[model samples]
Target: MKGTFPIEKFSHLSTPFYYYDTQLLRDTLFEINKEAGRHNFHVHYAVKANANNRILSIIRENGLGADCVSGGEIKAALKAGFPADKIVFAGVGKADWEINLGFDAGIFCFNVESVPELDVINELSAAKNMVAPIALRVNPNIDAHTHHYITTGLNENKFGISLSHLDQVLDHLSELKNIRLLGLHFHIGSQITDMDAFKSLCIRINEIQEHLYQRMLIVDIINVGGGLGVDYENPDRNSIPDFHHYFETFYKHLKLRPKQKLHFELGRAVVCQSGSLITKVLYVKEGVNKKFVIVDAGMTDLIRPALYQAYHKIENITSDKIEEEYDVVGPICESSDCFGKIVSLNQTQRGDIIALRSAGAYGEIMASQYNCRSLPKAYYSDDL
Candidate 1:
């Protein structure tokens, strides 16, 4: 089934823009709160996904914390009115200025990825005569069974510290007077669908916790970074992710200490369903073997298809005729600018409106000015 779109309204606006269903966004956030609140789990919206100013404000209003990976993201979260105490800074390579920024703002904690990074944060904090709170990001080596580029939990990935070095890092933490180890963090990957992968992560974390317990070290937090996947093919069928099952997997498997808090950093699942890349068909070319529907929007606007070979449901929102197979492509100079090959859509015309479903996550945030094309403008449902 096709998603509901305001075809009349879309016709009046310029082509190649973004349209967000704000009501759907609110409903998704409500579901997240209701499910996570059941277990008293703290969730921080991953700011790397859809960092639009208005989107950030609405998410902040929903009472979700912010999980940022860069200094700019931290600034954006702070500007959106998220409390400093509710923001967590996380990244593999955080510059001195970024660490100072976190210390200045007094953010919750830093998810330190490496020993060198920890040392830098410690030195920077010591220079300011302040103690910095940190959580060690441990590499569990569990396979997320997703794409290689997004898989980060494995030892080969340069995201978190390896398990073999965890004990040494824990020992070294004592010497750094300016750094206080607050917790442990683990993130397998993004767009993970199998619950068993998370189940494995829980088991690994439990083992690590036991190891820490044996050393007489009990951290106050266990942050299992988010990798919840959404239904991209059937956005209408599943507007929201299976949060109950996702949270329950961790709750049932992960064992926590007394007064210990469980944190999550969710990005895609929170906003993927509420957005669509609205583009107009600039031309319909008839090929010898197949027809092509060329769109005005290119990789400059939405690069997921070309970048990750990702799939987004393509719908001719303005058509009511029979379905036909057509290769939907963009006007970008690169040959990889194809959105979908042999995509079946209703009989499309040169000016028919097309909606690329489930693009709220990494869509607009990853858009580039390649080919010197202008960035796409975003319009919300309420504003319309």
Candidate 2:
């Protein structure tokens, strides 16, 4: 590592915790701000990926809005000091209380996924005697070019409203007095590496926008949901994603109307590389067929590996010995608890501090209390 981290100092106090490099986070945010400013784009940090209080505060300080998916998330964003006007609530199946909560909070707008959902919001807003502004999430049927599990823009997915139903939506728009359409929204998938997928989405958005404009629809906002992935295999080489390429893809392909503010809801790319999951080797066992390194940090601390078969660089930060092959695993009861199988790392021993790199996103935020484990505490470099 180019920068030194005092692993020895924290090894005595905790076996598993999240370590954040605030400097790297600031640099990533600066890149996002610089590029987004050039295009006059508005960004909302997707809180579903990572909502740690400190991390949320840092992201809020960057002046990006909060994209929340649930009622609890909206409450969390507010509790974290995100302005109501800068918060956007979205989900396919929002609860009645959740819609009422957003209505009371007066958030920016609800990203409505279905015509039925639109009716529900209108009903809720009508109950409160309030007009609710919304953006219709349009199903573009474009491939996200990522893992099959994450791709949501296809017709098979139950995410956004299909193009076949737009006529129905337009039919109801006149009747829904409490609902006001702001613009269109689209999100294909998460962790997409192919820039062409985004370009395809832009072309489709253009087609949709043109069709809507022909129907006398005035577009005020265009929300392209965030699914930008980051480099996990080589975290050292690419701590942050190429903001230039990402933004340029949109700038070149997306046809925008005058004064139409483009909104991006990014989560992973902004925070993934700046954090690491620090765990200590609880035991090292060598069997005839395999060598196993048991880590205190299980899938409970970071579930991306188990959930998405995701990869994060492993490092023996506290060891100086030669490398060896071992299957790094956590104490979880499930067979999927293995972090990496037959991975080569420094000759690890009991109590060696291990670091799982590129875990800044979907790491701590996805953590659960399974196996009766308490959530891991987080430490920032600024605090150290």
**What overall lDDT goes with each candidate model?**
0.95, 0.89
Candidate 2 — which residues are off by over 4 angstroms? 1-4
Candidate 1 stretches greater than 4 Å from native: none
Q: Could you tell me how far off, in angstroms, the CA of residue 355 lies in candidate 2 after the best superposition?
A: 0.4
Q: Which ten residues in a row have the lowest lDDT in candidate 2?
A: 1-10
For model 2, how does the per-residue alpha-carbon lDDT over 1-384 read when each residue is reduced to its tens digit?
A: 422577767766676999999999999999999999998889999998888888888899999899999998999899889999999988899999999888888899999998788888888888889999999998899988788888999999989989989868877887999999887889999998889999999999998888888888867999999898888778888887988889889999999988888999999998998999999999999889999999999999989889888888888888778889999999999999989988898899998888999888889988999989999999998888
Question: Candidate 1 lDDT, tens digit per residue, 111-213?
Answer: 9999899889889999999999999999999999998989999999999999999989988888999999999999999999999999999999999999999
Residue 73, candidate 1: C-alpha displacement in angstroms: 0.3
State TM-scores per candidate: 0.99, 0.97
Report each candidate's C-alpha RMSD, comma-separated, in the order given: 0.7, 1.2
Question: What's the lDDT for residue 270 in model 2?
Answer: 85
